[model samples]
Target: MKLIGIILLFVTSMQAQNFELRVQAKTVIPGKKIYLEYITDLGKVIKIDSAVPSAQHTVNFKGQVKDQGAFYLLNFFDTPKPQKVLVILEGGEFIDIVADGVNDEDGKGNFTMKGDYPNVKYMLELMAISKEMETKVRKWNQEIQLDQKQEKRIQAEFTQAQTASTAKIKALIPQMGSHLVALWATNFLPAEKEMTSLVEIADRLGKARPAHPQVRQFVANLQRLQGVNEGALAPEINLATPEGPTLALSSLRGKYVLIDFWASWCGPCRRENPNVVKTYAAYKDKGFEIFGVSLDQNREAWLKAIESDKLVWKHVSDLQYWNSAGAQAYQVNSIPQTFLVDPAGRIIAKGLRGTALDQYLAKLFESK
Candidate 1:
């Protein structure tokens, strides 16, 4: 019935609502043309409208939109240095833009959008914070590579910044509610740590804007998160161990087990081995166990890393790199992903690392 309604709406073109875009930019030369464009799923840009600025350096564009909003690029196409500002065009909106025409250093946007444009406002805010965090991470990474003497200090600072940024991003995502802008913010969250939140947002947006193309795409993309969301049953992972015998994640169901997805070649994973080893040693006798799933293709490298890192826990791998069945089942696109499962085989937490992992384990086992 929903599909039929959407088809009928498309056929009748009755869902379309009028919109007006008013721009005030000192940089837009009078008599120059600016374009409003949207990118297709295949990434091809399609120009939908154009406006010529009057002698007052202002341009006005009128259009119609469907209930499902579109993300558009407002480009100064005829300028010497063409630049674009992204706008979310929801139906029935009268959007106003104010700009000096100077390009944003971060390449996000220099223009400030006004009027009832919550999605646009939130999307731009998220982009700004994301860019700021990325710049800090890049600087820290460069310093770590250049100066060996301060690696620990740099790493601590990096971790602190990452944790803070992740917290801030998470706090902001809920404010977006079911807006498509929430989809943009979800990219900043670590899937393992925030799977529950991601799934909730997906469910909400899926219902709120089921017919929206981007919303449908985002909800579909997060299907993996839904499977392993907190309290969901941990997916079974049966693979060959390092010594060649088959083992299953279910075998450790009588205790707290962490499904550790890592690769021998992963630098961050290798560096994090010591913390895992420490955590394992501290809680192994208290019914805590780890099931390490290696995404390494090289047999010798995998064995060497396990031995060198003193990882004495049960470890398995198909030696198929990222194509390992375990990785595919858990949707582990990035290395060092983990799932903490209870004795009942339900996932409790994920992406725990460093001191956070230790603190959590202490809370769980120390009292017992």
Candidate 2:
């Protein structure tokens, strides 16, 4: 019985030694310390190991990699354990492991590399591409700075910079297609026709790199955004209203509804409310409605602003500031955004202000 107990203890200890990581090297300098990190849905960072392992160690994580894009790993340290870690990439690959015999004595272990085993030549190519992209962007910014100093040359230089940047990005797209698609989909792509192209790129890359999680995520995000663009049926938004009930966007169908995205702190939005109020008053009896979506952190301030501005309209918010559900659904990065939906609940116009808003309403009324 004593010998059986000893055998069970040995097995338990072995089980506890397992640490699986799907690490993407952020910055690896052969024999030096490397930095790695990852991001989650809650916007939290998970840092794994920072030690310079004398030799390669086994990193086991279940995540995918895409071509020419930032790769992330879903690290699970110890099976059936809830501990999570993230490995963020800075630049380069090739981590030198310091001799730690905890896992293996040879200082070499299995890790996911850019290319198939015994050949990592593609990683060097990726590094060069990253460096080249950085250099081009930097040079373009310098020219832009010089142009900004000269008001007369500003427009020309700005245009040139934009053209050059777009060209550089386009040229590198094939090589760094995955990274470019990820960045564009996550940050750069406008809420316009550009989105369609971005989605297409993501789809293509996802097919090429079927094992990449980032590509899958990028594709998923673009699909969601594409569903919300103009001409598409407006997504249903059911949220808490001041009247102690839930208000839904779908319920406002059959009327021209202006989804006003704003915050109490937005000076431009506050200034433009008078014009909106005038338009609302004029069109209220003509089957028009205005729904106020506040991106305010403070609920009291939002309510006070609504009352003070005499914004006698349906208002709703999840009170998440920039992280608001409506903001994410509408893909709003900035405030003072407005969407004009036709009676059929399809976005007809966006970002209309002052004269533009008035002109659109006039056209809508005249057409009726």
Candidate 3:
């Protein structure tokens, strides 16, 4: 459930174990508060503990943790500026931390752990490197937008940076002793390229850290990955058309169907509609069709986008924004996503957009 107070809880009830948190913050005022929060498996942020600093400019939190291997956050808004520090926490670990309350220009502090907190240290280091890599990649993206001619070099720099970061992260996996941190670290790398390592890490941790949320999440992600593999049968999407008629994705079985997920409010989808329309016009006669699923709250806007974009494809929606049945069936996290399915309802490729979409259609139509 959603949590609003300091007594919120999460999953996996285990034997209660004492967790000692020692914090030193010179910046926190004497009368203010510091909240210790933990995230639930449902992505809910809950406050588990709160403290008011005494005379020593320090706060000590002693509580019984009911879950093991979950992430915890220490949030401080009492100071002139806010501060937050993340720690990979467990049930029995007593974490001793030092916070000076004055971080660098970027608000990133030099948080250091006192005792043997290997997993936490490894996680923090990985996060620091990941942030640097993200900054570099963002620059590459900005450059690519302005200068498409140098896109190849800018893109190469991004890939090379990702490769280096992945290599460094992989080297620390075995050294972290427990696969708990390693499992969480995989989020920094591209999931497609790191699938093998992901499976190996998950298998190793599933036996040891079965109660961990990260381990459980890894297992669930792996299952979804298997279900949505390139050749797996595309998950069924049956929703209501605008005219109060039910439309099922399986009905478009015997053709090359692009299951396009979009919305009227999405700018990227509107921008990309012309490409989709062009491709459909070129390939509509050659056994190709598009099944448009919209995540829109208003039926009028949905109809407007279809007519404004001049989309001559089959369209359907349940008038539910972000909670549409079709969006959930396809596990769409963002708008303008597309999946190309073959005649027998097997997904051939995914994420084909813009010129890439045109090139794919050209190859498909020319092969015959």
Candidate 4:
């Protein structure tokens, strides 16, 4: 019995997370079919399998999942729309899905799951915590704008809030063990500020979940970050301009270029445009150039933003919104991100905004 237990633990630990969905669907019309679906990390929704419940209102979906934590959906043929549920793919255990039909209050399905439940709970908690922090940040921004006199205090409060959030997340990492949350927090760690924990988590994950895609992805992202950091050659981004001309980033070599990542719909990006305009005006003559890479899906809105902001600079995009191929090459997770490149096309600085942009350019020219 002891040897069997040891063997089982060893096998389970080595295996990637599998999924088992014991679905509930008695409320559906007779002879109706239901499909099991899962969402990819890249936001692609894929159908796993389909089944007709065996009169007991039960449908079982068993499969090998590619992700440790993923969103799955139950699509009833009889229903007008599919019902979504978050499921645990963390493997080594059963995941029982309860699709009790759509909630009348929320208009969303009351699809819940049990077994290997901690990870799912963690995901919900993480999202809620993140949302709370964002709400605070948004509130502070509004307050700061209305009362510039309180800007200093508000900024301090914001910093404190962010610090607390980081600390809370960092504290949760060790508790998460080798779960997907720990690997994901690698990206959430404050880049350089939380380097120690990032390295530790990377090493821990490398040892514990080396075969996991999230671990592999975490490692890949670190490499990309290093490649794009200051002193590294700016990655080439050659895409078509709004006009039909090929606008290559490498074409602007031998000049200071700001690889500005923004979207037309981005409020912060719109707010930061005037500062970029000011910076461009001040230093365009000094071989300073702006290469605006938009994450806009609508071409008209993108063009309108450029005209409204008077962004007299080279702009290029594939116009795929958040999934822009150009943006992906740069590993952009958020808008209003900038990569300042030197004349030789090596990245010099990053994330500069407002007068910081002007000040950096001023210093660069002054130093010579």
Candidate 5:
């Protein structure tokens, strides 16, 4: 009787300790087949389930007691490769993601109370700061609507909020600094065009946490990005074209080159191609050229965009969106971004658009 009681107790404990997860998704378009792909360790992909005609479906999984690591949920919509959605099963109370189509490749959403990690407190605090900053920004925008004087005042306030947020991030650097710094340093600082300041911050962080993996990676990525910034020598690129011909970026030396980072399906990039065409045509005679590096996984779409845009320039891509070798080399996180390199192969301008591109090129030609 004693042995039987002990066995029953063990069985009850096992049942209570089991963990489970369920995912439900609704596709935006009807008849568009949607599925969930669960990526596991060692690059294995486990298909969860397919959406039914009702627009919603679910997938369930039981957590293993011995397995301890992060699991990601990817959304597939008629694409071979999956887009990452939820970073589920991580031990955290809340996870703040920047969302899809909002300045990041991964969709932004927050998970509350999902983990037991101590560093989660820092994440929560950062989320609070982000919320506060959003509120301030909204208020400032409202003031900007009032008057010209109010607009200037609001700009100052916005800058102050940004500064405060930066400070908060700096203070949190010592504890949960690695991931935080990487996220911010990669996304924010460059967008703000604070390259010099970002370099200093990255360098300092790199030295302070020499052994930290994320910090080291961030430092390396930032350094590479900074090397391609304005007034820095452009990084060399050597890739094979679809026609089995080898080409090198250095071969285009002694001419002004506009290194255009774009994707085939990128709407913004497609819209901006007309301006690029105008700029290229106006400046090509003045030794200007464009080397388009497409972040496109499909060769057909890539060629279609180039031909449709009447883009008569050198095009190169490994046909890997986001994971292209050139994308990694250039640290291109966003599309429709162009680097204007001088005749000496040094970057002189970036993100030039419309009249800005025209004016800058006019000046460059006039100087020549």
Candidate 6:
């Protein structure tokens, strides 16, 4: 009896952190392999394992999950374009996927996922909604780009679609409760506009999956967001200027500052420079300043862009490219990103461009 008890305990421990994923393909071609892949925090996709379907047209993958909230991609690599499905696998899950061998005329996938785990079901559903939204937006943008009126109409349509998609995703969050799907749903919304909801979901997910790597990462991102959000103190940045002297953002205190993150290779940044120049010309004497931070690897190109744009501003860079110290300090993932700081050095707004920047500055300097 004692030995039998020990054996049962061992069996239970063996299966505790493991998951089994089985796929049934309707039309399995010879020599084609299926891959199980996961993306890293840095957005690099790593292929973990691959398997060939058996004579019965089924393939199985089994592994122990390191952590929950990690999204995995199942890819059928033999197709003209690989057919892929996104799935979430917590430990101790048995997930089955049915794949239709042929994609539709529009290349839409005909697949269904079944799992006893409620989170898996919810995550898959959320992924479906996200994919649908992306498809709709892409199709709308791919139309004609002839006239300004037509462009305005297309943008309005895009805005309507985005509003409806956000509403749909938000409506599903309450039903998800403390599940990670609720946290994932918040990602579909703008992070700056929905920080309160994001923080709440992060709190709930922290209680449920405290040890998960993804949860930890999400919490860290929320902390960073808090530091950069409106009314929050802007993170400090100190980098070398074009003339070889170090300048600190704190030194520019008592003035309204625009922290512009750009690079010479960025086409949009070059195009937007004229508008920025215009805004600067209007406000430079009104206690307004521009602190340009370049994420350029080449020093020559950076200097040439600054000169060519007629940008008479305090420009600084570590010239580390995307790994620029200042860019990372402010969580800048794209070029031509700007943060507006008031005289008190608090972040007033972010990502302002063109007419938006002009309108904001106009209202701000109306009194002076």
Against the true structure, what is each candidate's TM-score?
A: 0.53, 0.48, 0.62, 0.68, 0.60, 0.63
Ranking by TM-score: 4, 6, 3, 5, 1, 2
Best by lDDT: 6
lDDT of 2 by residue, 295-356 (tens): 88787889899999999988998888766788778867566888889999898877776666
| Superior by lDDT: candidate 1 or candidate 5 | 1
Best by TM-score: 4
Tens digits of lDDT, candidate 1, 1-368: 99999899885564356678898776766566888887543234678888777777778888776346776777874464467777776666788887766555543335678775668778777777877776876676677569867766876887888788788788887788776678667666778667787788888888888888877766765786567678999989999998889999998888999999998877668877877998999999999999999998788889999999999999999987766889878867577889899999999988888777888999998678
Better of 2 and 4 by TM-score: 4
lDDT of each: 0.78, 0.59, 0.75, 0.74, 0.62, 0.79
Badly placed stretches (over 4 Å) of model 6 are: 1-10, 24-33, 39-46, 52-58, 75-84, 98-112, 139-147, 150-157, 231-233, 236-328, 331-338, 341-346, 351-368
CA RMSD per model (angstroms):
10.7, 13.2, 9.2, 6.2, 8.3, 7.1
Better of 5 and 6 by lDDT: 6
Worst 10 residues of 5 by lDDT: 95-104
Q: Count the backbone clashes (under 3 Å) in each candidate.
A: 0, 18, 0, 2, 9, 0
Error of 2 at 46 (Å): 8.0
Segments in model 1 whose C-alpha atoms lie over 4 Å from true places: 1-16, 29-32, 41-44, 78-82, 100-109, 138-146, 224-368
Screening candidate 3 with a backbone cut-off below 3 angstroms (N, C-alpha, C), the clashing residue pairs are: none
> TM-score of the candidate numbered 3?
0.62
TM-score of decoy 4: 0.68
Better of 1 and 2 by TM-score: 1
**On residues 1-368, what C-alpha lDDT tens digit does candidate 6 reach at each position?**
99999999988876876888899888777888888998655434679999888998889989887554467778885465567777766678899998875566656567888887867767777777877776775565456334445655665676687678777777777778866556557656666456677787889887887887777767776777667878988889999999999999989999999999998877658767877999999999999999999998889999999999999999999988866888667866566789999888899999887777899999999999
- Order the candidates by lDDT, highest first: 6, 1, 3, 4, 5, 2
Candidate 3: stretches off by over 4 Å:
1-17, 24-32, 52-58, 76-84, 91-115, 211-214, 237-345, 350-368
lDDT of candidate 3 over 1-368, digit per residue (tens): 34633233433233235567898876665577777888665345688888887677778887666455677778774454457787666665677887765566655555666656676778877987887875885576577669878766864676678689889998888787663577667665544456677677777777887777757766775767657768989988888887788998899988999999899877658866876888888899999999999988878889988899998899989887766777666645466778899999999988787666788889988976
lDDT (tens digit, per residue) of candidate 5 on 1-368: 99999999988766554445444333233454445455543324566655532434434445432222233454534454334454433222223322221112423333342334434455556667766876776566556457647754665666677787877765665454433323333343333255665666677667766654445565776667766768888888777665657677889999988888888787558756876887888888889898888888888888888888898989888887776788778877667778888878888998776566788889878977
Candidate 1 at residue 222, lDDT?
74
